[model samples]
Target: MRPGYGHTLRYLGAARGAITRRQPIFPTCYGDALQGSPVADITADPQSGWTGVHPAILAMNCLAYDAATLGNHEFNFGLPWLTRMLSAARHPVTCANLKLTCGRFLPPYLLLDRMIRSHDGEKHPIRIGIIGLVPPQVTSWDHLHLGDRLISEDMVKASRELVPRIREEGADLIVALAHTGIDTGPAHPFMENAALQIAAVPGVDALLAGHSHQIFPDSTVPGTDGGAVDSAIGTLSGTPAVMAGFGGSHLGILDLALRRHHGHWTITGHRSEARPVTSMKTGIAAAPDAEISRALTKTHAATLRLTRRPIGHSPAPLHSYLAMVGDSAALRLVNAAQHEAMAELLRGTAHENLPILSATAPFKAGGRGGPGHYTDIPAGPLKLRHAADLYIFPNTLCGLQITGALLRDWLERAASCFNRIGPDARGVPLLNPEMPSHDFDVISGLTYRIDLSQPARHAPGGALASPGATRIRDLRHAGKPVRASDVFILATNSYRAYGGGGYPDLPDTERIHTGKTQVRDVLVRHIRSRSQVAPPAGVTWSFASQPGASAILETGPGVRRHAAELAALGATDLGGGSGGFVRLHLPFDGPLASRGNDN
Candidate 1:
């Protein structure tokens, strides 16, 4: 389905119209069918009717798309369910790298024999080969579900091997549907951004890329070589490419002009671009397609009903506008839920005696998702939608055994979210824009302060930058300093525990428990189990005092209402920042009056 919101029906219609009158529109997707809904459970299976991507599949079938590819998120519900869903599509689902350990077969690529109209209005028969490749990181991201059931190959390697085979199968041209991002970094066996390398593969004519949720044909992206990307004229190693922005935001279009020479078809020229569904200047979106609206009426109604059902209550509001600045109630609640669930699961196990810690980050903090992305829930009945807002991904819960030193290192890596501040650099920006909000993790059950003056031990992407530098100070458990050898059980999602975000000190062998339950489901259950849930009041961590030194931070516009609360944490309202974010000035020497109490 349309992931978040936009007029997908109208977007698709516009995309269809962009092509030549007699040419067929090729629609492709890069996985992740659930969790993008403004309403939750649109991907959930209700007792009475079909759910998840069923409606989206129906819409695609109605549109008569030629073929599609798999994305990493497609396996969120597990392999069996994903297989069933893919099989239900009228169009072929092709992936060259995915392999099933259970002996289940999925074609490595798809070959389409179709007729195309040239500039002379003459139709020519052509065999077009489409190959799909997803990042191999899926094996780690979905380890619990796909551990023994399936495996994935490196995108570059898979493409190199499959492109020639597809060419030999009498195909005139080849198109790669790579669920990867474009980067000019040195090639690695399992690098996430392999689009450039994939493009260099022989016989590949055009490429459709995704998974970075970024738009090509835009000049915003910084290439790996430290240069601005001319996204508007997107290309990877001279091959025309387009990455449609996520969630129907844009449609990637690539036009190839072909010619027949010596009984062989070859691409002579090409053009590529991405079209947005919403107007950039006026902030207006296209109208929804009446036909698609009519087609999805029942499913949409059911999704709304299911998401609005009251599930629990919160004694205090849960918001994350100022999450990166101080202790966030929203993240605190999530940590509590993970801790509670993990504790219960280990009650009778040998590991029950170990202290339980939870690792959580503010997923809604404004970044790539834009300023309006913060989570703000009023104190009252909580709906499933609220829970989904609290924890966005469908990531499964996992418990890891780690030493105190390792935990400290983990926190140090997370502390890289902030920029190193100079003693006299008051009002200097404090955040590292390159660091994603998801990677700025805060650990519950431990008290520590991040000294922003010190160089961070790790870079934003989680690589070790300064091994000897220590930004985390006063790391303690139960009011006592944690020793390097002290062991603890950490409740985190499979992604972090399995080293998905480049977090250090965690090896998969250290995993003590992997729950089948999704973290969002755990949050819902935890909220329902309590009559009134509230985060412990006080700061878990705070900036080290630097008299007269101030730093600026950006948050959502709605944070103005909580100005006094922010002041208590040493932040003064300074109005707006760039990109719809509100700016706040925090004095390092100010008293931490709003610090939460440690339990």
Candidate 2:
């Protein structure tokens, strides 16, 4: 899928704030326009750095779509902005399945006639009837707004009603634009996705599905008869369905070959491809799409500027890379905030006397957040953007009650962030999501050892290293093994508390205490409570032993400045490699090379 001109337009909006809309907000639904710039607002480009979007959504308007459906991100900007944007769009936005009591289906489906070109250079007109539908689960994403709108009518039932009406209107073919995800394998009752359900609809001939951002190759939906199912427009059963990647990342191209016989057109051949946002001028991977960058440049610059504004002063800069190895400014800040929040929550609660400790991970650490994952908190007044940049996701705060056994399991899961070490090896991989850098568990009030020799017993199913496998052994709190039945209060985000991390026996949602506050608000409150927070006092965790050897992986062009300092401290600095990685000096004598490279 190609990004098309949308991204470029958005970039210009952000650069110049030319769009007549609100400023770009984090986790935005509207894209670069949130940051301001460009000539027009683009529905792609979430400022959080992900590359995904409903491709060429703008083209739907120019193509005079009978009725365009809504995708997941369409609601990302919240209802107000979405309503405004859709109102501004030239084409009518519609969804037969999602409607208000006033008879307006948000954007109701439209009826139209389209012109077509025959292979023989002949032009023809077709009476086509189209309707759009979306999944009901879209409510889960923006529950706040979705709460007000009526979310009833399943896609199947919706299609059954609308398709027949189109046919009655003398339209030859019934088309459905379903905003639903696809899973070809099973038909779980109570799990009626649009694709499978709509396929069974008698009146519909062709279907276009979005919200999955998936590309269908050769335009063929395999059938039980071991042959292609023919449709009025060609091979719509497998021929015409397509979804471009998200965020102006790709463009979906679908071509259909229709034949006329007995005064009716039938689809014969179908093809669909996901093309990149980059240029094909020379070849793939060579010409970076300037339009994409240009579209986002102005907005990107404005976003950076807005985020860079002074926030409340930090005595010590926060960082995630440091947290990856041991303690870091970013983790410490989170830990401090969580600790403060928990402490306040426990002030008069039943668990107040239990020597409370808060656990937090380095979520904003160096991986996807950006190259400079280090939070350089220069001293100053903090703003809303600063808080968002610091905490990112909209996850809520949740506290859980766990037994000592469960706590041990939790730490093991944290340790699992490290890779299984070869007998001759040492140190953990820098980016293990299970033991993901961000998920590195920090136990505030407990101290434990991570014995490298033992296999890591992370998660619940079974011993990840093998029965009795061990990475975390001899778990103790205050110099003694924790009692099995000893109940303790554990604080974590709502996402993990709901079994998001694959940790076992932790699916106890009843133990959860929801906070009406957002995570960023909690951090700001915690920071204000402290009046001043510092990086953790010291390293609370460390490697049991150096890898068979220790290696230094440098990062950034300015890494040399720290090289001499690290080498003098007994480490070797291996020079640079690919992925924007630089060399670091580490005294690693392991079987593996002592060099580290990172993008």
Candidate 3:
């Protein structure tokens, strides 16, 4: 349901056209695209060509959404901007979980009385109740704006408290518009994925879930309990559900057959599915609706001009195709910029003398976004779009005071990106498909080696998996071994510093500095400060020497162009793997260890 900046107006127009043909469209959007910062400042002066959230609001208004919900990214521009956007919408915005401790501009739920055409061509009046839910982590994710002004209760708990009340208010059918994922893992108080739990609630007849940015009814999804999820028949706790992929890639549809019995309407049968705007195998590619495109033409042109504006120049090409293998120019540029910004921000503070370690992850490493998602900018003029591509999210820069022990634990958690490799299992796949690229953080101010032979100390969800296992080795800061008690101010995004990824030992008390500036802005400023930027060349960490051990890494297909550079790293081309990834074989030897030791 999240229509971010990635999709063009043309794409959205095409998606909307498909939705109208099915039924009375109840359009829903899960926020985060009014202003993506350095990428496209939609909030740039009102007199300017950029129309801020006007175009987005107009587009949704044209579709005539029955009701909508706010995603976590809705607060990217602060509560005031969001309040104005909501006010501009023709339809009401419902969010049951978000409590305004100070003031309220949105409703908790909306009841719509609609006349639906039954199977026999008879019109039946039904009261449809819609409730919206956003993740409770929004407070921590956008602490600068929300702080103590907003309070988000648990999704499941909120649904239980509000659903019955909505039902009592003459709601024939209840539809939960949850901005959460459908993770079937163990339930936690503030779990990011609470769709399954919410679906189990008695009054919830149907649900539309989002926020994981992944497709549902996807038969390929494996459950955490070693079971396969029948995503094709999207259901949670026997309740029909749908989760449309992000950026208007797909439109989720849930068709329910209702029956009137005992003076009450109930869902008798339901079918849930997601339709893609463009499908290669089915050979269906629809054109954008002329009306929608015409409406957004001005905003689209303005965004293009702003994104393509030259910011600076890079001496060498920046690409994330090989980021997982070693240090890439794109990641190095982000780390350097974040480090510089944090260093300056902490000046004159108590944390000024503390060593600043910038932690960043490769945003476009080709996993869920597919092969073409990799950031590959040719060496030449660097535009604002390039910097945006380097650091994708709108997360603000923050500094956290963490001990050496916590840092090592964080690295160990990052090391979970790789699958455990046995010494005898040669030619096995190295990267774990479950570990997201964003979770594989790499700190810039330290040197370490990851021992692939050892098991991951933490699981993908950040729980301790192997108690004594140690993947991070040779941990040193400034050529000296860092003790467990050594404290350092880590430069990271608000998400990580606020324990977004369930990182061990980081709490609000540890936060030392929080900057209002977005991280992408810092990257742009860092680039503009210099005429020609060249990132440092070398690998910070590498797999431990396994002698005869060999593993295959899957990356974007574009890696073939850098064959010579990859050969130097002892990686042999093994041709293409499944999806759009090219396989590269790495053979571990003593000489490779020496190359990995370079700072």
Best model per TM-score: 3
> Positional deviation of 503 in candidate 3, in angstroms?
2.0
Q: Tens digit of lDDT per residue, candidate 3, span 471-567?
A: 9888889888889999998889987877776675356688888877879889989999999886656566766777778788888888887766687
Show model 2 residue runs off by greater than 4 Å: 1-309, 364-383, 414-418, 425-445, 448-470, 474-480, 501-509, 529-532, 546-599
lDDT of 2 by residue, 32-59 (tens): 2121111122232244343322223333
Give lDDT tens digits, candidate 1, residues 234-284: 667777788775667676777655566566765555567777667766767
TM-score of each: 0.89, 0.58, 0.91
Error of 2 at 480 (Å): 4.4
Prediction 2 global C-alpha lDDT: 0.50
Error of 1 at 328 (Å): 0.8
Off by more than 4 A, model 3: 1-22, 31-41, 44-53, 103-105, 222-229, 282-285, 504-509, 589-594
